[model samples]
Every structure is written in C-alpha cells, then in structure tokens.
Target: MLFKKLYTKSLFRICPKILSISSLRYATAPSSYAETVDLAYSSYESTEDETSVRPPVVILHGLLGSKNNWNSMSKAIHKSTGRKVISIDARNHGDSKHSSQHTYLHMAQDVIKLLKKLEISKVSLLGHSMGGRTAMVLSLLSSDLVSSLIVVDISPAKTSPQIFSMVNLFDAMAAVSLRSGIAMSKARKLADEQLKAVIPDINLRNFLITNLIQTNTGSYSWRVNIPALKENFQQNIASFPSSLKGLQYCGPTLFIGGSLSDYIGKNDLPEIQEYFPLAQLQFVDGAGHWVHSQKPEKFLEIACSFLKDK
Candidate 1:
C-alpha cells in the first residue's frame, strides 16, 4: 500500500514557484520582509584556557533540521579541537524567525550577520545537505569570512533526484489534520499514519516528524516554515545558481560523502574541483545521506583532523 502511494506521488510533479494560494493558505504571513534573516544559534566554548588559539567552527544543519540536532556533535568537536563551536538554526527553522523568502544567498548572508553579531572575524564552516550548499555559496560569495569549508554529502552541481522525494513527504505532512487542542500523541499518530503511506523509511519519517511541535493552543505545528520551503523548493533548494558558475573558492575544502548515498559520486568530482580548487573528497563506509549522524565517530575524526590541519 505504501509503495503504491509513493508510486502515485512520484507521478505528480509541479513547479515550486507556481504554488497556488490554496496550497499555502495554512501558512502564516512572515513577520518581516528583510532580505537578511536573523539566525538563532547555540555556542560551545572550550573550558580550557587555550581556547583563544583554536579557530571557531560554525555548523549549519540541513533542511528541516535545527541547531539542536548538532548539540552533541558540537560539544564533541569543541572537546576534541578545543575550538569554539556555533550551531545555528537557519531562518524558518528552530527558534529563528520565519520569512517568505528563503535562498542560499539570503541564508549565507544570515550566517555572515550572525558572525558579525558574535564578533567572530573568521570561521571554519561545516554544513550538511542544504546547509552544505549554503556553505559553498557563502565561501564563494565571501571567501574572506571562511577559513576552511567542510561539505557533507552534497554537491553544488545540481539537484539530486532524492530531493523530489521530499516534496512528497511535505505533501503528506500538509495533509495531516490537527485541530486546536488535539493531543500530542494523537497528532503524531495521525501524522505518522499519513507519512508512512508516502515515506516508507522509518528513519526519514522520524527525522521529519521532529519538526512537529505542539502549539501554545495545544494544536500540532511544525517548527519549520514548511510552506516557504515548499514554495522555494525548485527556485532555491533544487538547483545551484547559474551566476556562481564562473566563481571559485580557493580555500582548503573537504567534501565528505556517505558510501551508500548517491548525493555525491565520482562524476561530481570535476565540478566540485572546478569550484573548489583545493578540495579533497572522502567517504564514510556503511553510511547514507545522513553521514554524520550515522557514523559520528568517523565523521568527527575526519572533521577534527581537517579543522586542526594548517
């Protein structure tokens, strides 16, 4: 039954920009119209006295993920490298303010603003999936602000076919019913039933459902701005910008892929090297798209080594 539903969804495709008003009627209006997003973040600073010598690391999560996802990892990184770690909740995700517009340009700018606000002159950036793409764009747009870059399981070439599956998942989430004052358990049960029909993978479904939160009124809502994300899927998330084609970021860069994930393949190396001339690629065994989460030890080892290297 789930397979049949997924097959039917795969046949339905629509341009993200052409979303009708009815499609987004459930979404609330954005609080502001500013081009720059005011990002919310958490910091992990080293307890040792030598913290000043270690460069700060800024971590960005993927789509539908919040800074809280990186909490443990950030602490681990800080402990290992004795560096300050900042895990940011990108706009429209976690505690950050939602906006009608979401793009890599705006996301990258938001990161810059956060850095300035924190008085960080330069940082080592580590990003996963959508965040990886954001880091790449930011490195190219403002190379001076980034000392090093680590891109996890994502390429800047083009959108992978895997992204389309997310559309179906979002559609399923939007279809779930959640009246005010509904029990959290009941809401989750309802959402899971609807999501299971479209997303068969339990891990993915679990990850997506983390965005579901109980509103003050006791109704279920999503921490992420799903409507904005859905609307900008093709225009932003699904494609790399054409304007950045000729641009290059000549900093030390590492591209980490999961052996089981098709997000990054050998064929992608040329384009990656084209944009990041000093880039090196590596892969973690027995892992998928969520490489860091799946193989935390290996991911952290590689990450700390790369960041520590001069």
Candidate 2:
C-alpha cells in the first residue's frame, strides 16, 4: 500500500501467523499496518481522530521487550489522541527477526525497514531504554522520517558499565535446567528464584520470564538471543558512531529522565544538548530508569501537551 491516510472507523486487527526459517522462528501478525507480508515484525495500531491528519507515532520498547510491552501506553495514547499509534517489536526481542548479533545500528535499521514498509514518510517516535537509543540513531539515520522524538531515561553519553550486572540475572535464569514437558509455572518459579535478588518487583520478573517460550519439541527456551545480547551488552551502552558527531536533530524533541535514575543526570545534559540542541528536558519525580512506566500519567501529560503545542 502507498502512503495514505487511515480512517478512524477502520481499526487494524492483526491475525497471528507462525513461520519457521533456517535462521529463526517467527510469529507474524497480518493486518493494515503495511501490505508487505514477509517482513518479520509485529505492530498494533490505534486511531481515534477521523479528520485529523496527525503524523504516525511509533513506540519502541527496550531490550528484551516486544511490541506487547507498550500495550497499555499505546492504548492510552490512542484513546487520548485521535492519531495513529504503532508499537513495534524490535529485532531479536519480540516476533521480529532474531539474529546472532545485536547492535544499535542493526536495531535502528529494523525500525527503518518497518516504517518504509508502511510507507510512512514522517513519524513521531517514543522509545524507552535501548529503544531510546534506537530512536536517537533513527533521527540521525533517517531524519526526514522522524517528525518529533522522545527519548526516555537515556542519553548519548556512554552509560556506566556497572549497570549491566543485571545480565547475571539472565545468566541465572538460563542456568535453570528445564525439559520440554515442564510448565511455564515451574519455569517462572525457577526464573524468579534466580532473579529474586536483582529484581524486587514480581511484576517485572514475570515480564522477563515472558521471553521464555515452549519450543515445538516441547523444550523451554528464551526467545531472545541471550549470547548475542551478552556479547553486545557493552556496545549497547557505548556512545554513538563518530560520524554522528556534528549531527543535531532540531525537531521538537523531549528528553525525559527519572528522578531516582542516574542514567540521565545534570552531567549528561550538556552532551545531550550538544547532540539534540532543540530537545526539551523533563525529570519525573519519584521515578527511576523506567520513568514512563513508573509515571505514565505525567509522561502522557508531558507528551500530549508537547505534541499539541505548535
């Protein structure tokens, strides 16, 4: 399908399809997002306004998360604004393509391919954690495709290496031996035990365990490329390419950080300004790294008001 406007009366309903490839397994969703069927990605579109020509807004989730991760926020945003919203499954995490290598460049390209397939000329972007980095790179890689950008609790500066100690949590979970006949409940219990010390939130623990899937052979395994993620963990926290040195996105951008999260601090503000000179910064009180999920109402308020403003 070429570039065109979608009516509010038509709600996109994607039907799930399972596909097997030599490289990886995929669950494809079919609907109106894009006409192309072979692309390995999933999307949820929610629209409200019938006459408004609001630019498409795409939401990208963090590492180890799928498009479903933004189900709540995407629905909320769609209900609040009559504009189209798309939540995408980034590569290696969700139903998207799973490769042995994970890098910001490759992830950003996956999003770009999705947008191209949708024939989206321009879009507003909101990303969390690793997703935030992808959005930042997207703006640099395909500036014209991005109308506005929102980076949640992340900056271009190199993040502290110590933060990735959490990978041990994944290691611990992988260490748990389970057969194909084992139930998810048992797998959940084992993963919880491994992650209990690191993740205090039961809900978050469950969210991570959702990546664990039952294989066709009845074996339980993680959907994510754990070894690839482990190897690229440092690159995930590393700075952007030097070619992006002088690149500055002048769009209506917002940089949101958590009050309790050290990921984005006053020290990182200058570097952020250097890269995103037009960015507006807001720090959410009583929130941490997961600022948007932690303070949805405030995040929505800020986002809505910003988008509405000329």
Candidate 3:
C-alpha cells in the first residue's frame, strides 16, 4: 500500500524555541509548531516491570507499517531488557504526520525532532526495512543521540523489483473502493483476493490493508500519501552514502538479515563497514525480507542480548 505521501509538505515541524541544556523541558512543543503540520505521534512507554535505567530504545517500522507493527517486539524488548522503548511512526506512517518528501534525510530529521521534543538525550536505535535505512541516516546525521544500532533485514542498497512490487500493491489498493460501508471482514477478504497474485501471504496483505480507514462520508482511504509514495518509489530504494571515507559510528552495531531474502549480502559489507566500522552481521534462517515479523522470538533474543550487553 503506497500509504502517505513522501513529500506532502506536511512533514516539516519547525521548533524555533531554543532550550538551555540546563533546562531540558520534556513534552514542550517548539515555538515553530505552528508551521505546516500533518500527522502527530506519541511514544508508548514500557510498563514498570519493563522499565530500565538505560537510555530508551526507539523502534522504527518499515514501509506501510506504523509503530503498531512493532508492538510485539517492543513489549518483548522492554520486558527482557527492562529498558524504556519508544516505537515511532516515522513521519508518513501510522498516526504520525505525512510529508510529500520521503527522502532518507527528511525521515532522519523527523526522528531527531521527536527525540528533542521528548527530552531524550540518548537512545538505542532499531529499525526494519525502510525504517532501517532511516535509522542508518539518523546515526550518521546525529550520531550523538544514538548509542547502538540494530538493522533488521534491510541494507543501504537499491531494491528494484521490491520497489515495483510495492508500487503495484499501492496501485491495487488505490483502485479498490469500499465507500459503501463494507465490513472489516469483507474488506479484508476483498483485499486478500485483490493482492493474492502479488502478495500471496494472507498475513502481509491484511497487514498493509489495515491502513484503510473508513471516512465519515463512508469512503475507504489509506492514511498514507498514496500519490507521493508511488511517485517516489525509486528514491525510497536508493543506496546509502558510501563515501563516509572518515565518518563512522563506533558504537555496537547489529545487522540482521533474512537468509531467504536478498536485502543484505556479502557484497554490501564494504559499504556497511565503511559507514559503521563496528557493525556485526547475522542471518535468520528460513526468514524472508520481513525478518522481524517472520521470526519475532529470534529477533527479540538478539535485540535483548545486545541491549543488555550480556
């Protein structure tokens, strides 16, 4: 589903108010909050049992996924590590604001703003697919805020076929009309049938179609910017910068890829190391591109181990 627009002009949030380091204010909106706005987001703090003294872990979801997609993983990480977890809906996804521009730099800036607003001095980063790319850019742009980096089943590389497939799914979703009050069950059934040829997995089809929101006028539409994402699909799959020449993140870095997927491979290591010298690569057997969702427990085990430094 080509959800929110990549550059809808609703993504930028200007915070002109400068806060003194001594007076770190939590939950204070920036003075420039009045500028162009679209979706808003809130963090879900871990329960007392899952709370920890370590810096919070920020989780970013992939394309067509909101923070909700990380619910299971977030909860598990929290409980296992007792560290606070903040699952973020990167700009155009979930309940967050949508923007016309979906560039990696723009997406990274969104996370920075959110962290500043939350008064978070430092955070551990975890991202999947598109979110993984966003996290990588964030670490490069604002390395101070990041402690460790965990990438799930995605690399800083071009994904041509995957991009085309995503465009097709978005096209299919845009073509469907459920404005006449179709039941969720019926809508899901129809979505499954429509996407069956392209997305054979019933679970993934349902996951993407969940973005369908029933409007007051009874028309079903997606929360994502359809036109923007479909138009900028190529930009989304663009490679990460390989000229880090001297730049690098020394913190512990984990790269988890799917054995059955082409998202990461030996050929990508040079660039990966060039940017993140301490990065470690691992693979989840039998899993595909969506490694986190396909193998939640294994993903959790690796994540918790890293976060706990055990």
Report the C-alpha lDDT of model 1 over 47-91, residue by residue, as the tens digit: 672447656999999998999989999999988888888999998
For candidate 3, write residues 147-264 as lDDT tens digits: 8899887876545355457777778777775546877678767766777877777787878887877678765678877777776666554455443234456567888887778878
Ranked by lDDT from best down, the candidates are: 1, 3, 2
Output candidate 3 Cα RMSD: 9.9
Best by TM-score: 1
Q: Any runs in candidate 1 off by more than 4 Å, and if so which? A: 1-34, 49-51
| Candidate 2 per-residue C-alpha lDDT over 1-310 given as tens digits, one digit per residue, 9 for 90 to 100 | 1111211122133322212341111112212222222224444454345224667678888877778778888877766665677888776776766666566666766777777778877888989888898898777656677888988888887574546775775576567567667777887787678777767879778878878888888888887777777777765534454445555666668878877887777567567765676666777778888776878888887777666651
Note each model's CA RMSD in angstroms.
10.8, 11.8, 9.9
Query: What lDDT does candidate 1 reach at residue 5?
Result: 10
Worst 10 residues of 3 by lDDT: 2-11
lDDT of each structure?
0.79, 0.69, 0.70
Ranking of all candidate structures by their TM-score, best first: 1, 3, 2
Q: Which candidate, 1 or 2, has the higher lDDT?
A: 1
Clashing residue pairs for model 2: 49-82, 180-218
RMSD of 2: 11.8
